[model samples]
Target: MRGSFRIEGHAIASEDGMIAAANGLMPDSLKFPSDQKLYEQALDQAAVIANGRLSYEGQLNSPRRKRLVLTRSVSGLAPDPKNPNARLWNPAGESLEAACAALGVTGGEIAVVGGPFVFSLFLGIGYDAFHLSHAPGVRLPGGVPVFHEQGSGRSPEDVLAAAGLKPGPVQRLDDGVTMVEWTRAA
Candidate 1:
């Protein structure tokens, strides 16, 4: 945990490290019941969830957990007109700490669900742990990578390692799906 904040990231990506198709949408091929269950459970324990507009829109009916939606539409932090439990945020204009403070979230798990940009932002900020699940036999070529850079000779593992996170032992989830908990390197 970093300074009383237990930041964690959750994502399910294709074998090729794509989290979304070229159309900027997450394909069904990446979804797994096992992963969804774990993702929901993790979110339930989090004090606040943060994601980009696309990620936030994708899960519109998600349980009413407090959320911060990243968008350039807001100068900094502003009320989400549609959801009283949410806030529209522009990290470029304000610090994450200030955004969280606006939502009355002092310290607890900050669950970061993602599109590539959101994931990349948190990677820069640092994560206490990242739960990465893979859908075996699936590949989304020319799709959105879990990290920002692609076709750059760096795999998602390389990106995570560069961010100082080490993978824990792998666990088989379901139907060939596997998961690895990446934590800060000791």
Candidate 2:
């Protein structure tokens, strides 16, 4: 999951915890530079669990769009009878386990791009790996925390460790950003 890290570990672009403000737009100051190619390549052939907004616009527009599965939680929503690429998940009506099974999402890398709630949901289930990116020199003071349960005084890394993931080497990305991968400890 990709999150913006500030010195204080805040996640959202602002205190409102809105990725995009009332206008549905993020300010330039909050936008961190990223490798577009890497992001595109990762989405190829991957099952993407994203919110309704992103499912329709962002991921669906990719060139590897055909290989991607769009899963969202919307009441009364379902994959088109003829289309195997979309899945509608009702968290209130179904278990995450059941949703995954119904989507036929089994035995491969599952990318979880999220808001804090989604990240917290998966934390309980467990993650085989987590790629945490830190953008130095940027701070979203009073912004949302990447892990909703965080700021009870525990750092995100501490939360991951508590969940049994072991940190891997740090990989530096462009623009003063760095990422560290954490794998479930054997």
Candidate 3:
């Protein structure tokens, strides 16, 4: 609440691998076009990071957020070409602790936002805080699960607590929809 922190969450139906499916990683389904705006914001955020609009660089140049995008198809367009961000290293070679240190965000708030797989990586690497939305879950028969085999090694909440995040008030939107906010454990 005082400084920068790592952020992680999911969207059930992103075409670009950033969105989640209808049934989330948890086990229940959300009540589908409801979270459309939220996904739009996610794309907007991705654009800002991709366009080098975040963080200070003597003149506010680009995303120095140490981004590690997780995607099955790595042939997409490059977001930040100035070397502000690094390509994802999948399950290994991209340690969160090391990245945090390199980005000078240690002891400060570190953010991690993406699909379930990425959250699992962060969880394995010890990241806290999960700000997720409860949307109407949809089922994709051949869809991928939120956490991968390697990601499933640890509990996300455990990593979050160790990393300084804890459960907070749940903000439910409309009637059944809700936005759950978590913070670093103190």
| TM-score for each predicted model, relative to the true structure | 0.93, 0.67, 0.46
Candidate 3 local lDDT, residue 139? 38
Worst 10 residues of 1 by lDDT: 56-65
User: Which candidate, 1 or 2, has the higher lDDT?
Assistant: 1
- Summed backbone clashes in each candidate are 0, 0, 26
Query: Top TM-score: which candidate number?
Result: 1
Query: Candidate 3: global Cα-lDDT?
Result: 0.42
Screening candidate 2 with a backbone cut-off below 3 angstroms (N, C-alpha, C), the clashing residue pairs are: none
Q: What value does the lDDT take at residue 166 in candidate 1?
A: 97
Local accuracy by lDDT, each model? 0.85, 0.51, 0.42
Q: How accurate locally is residue 181 in candidate 3, as Cα lDDT from 0 to 100?
A: 60
Where is model 3 more than 4 Å wrong at Cα? 1-66, 70-84, 87-91, 100-107, 149-167, 174-176, 182-186
Judging by TM-score, tell me the better candidate of 1 and 3. 1
Off by over 4 Å in 2: 1-27, 30-36, 50-84, 101-104
Lowest summed lDDT over 10 consecutive residues: which window, candidate 3?
Answer: 47-56
Supply candidate 1's per-residue lDDT for 101.
84
- Candidate No. with top lDDT: 1
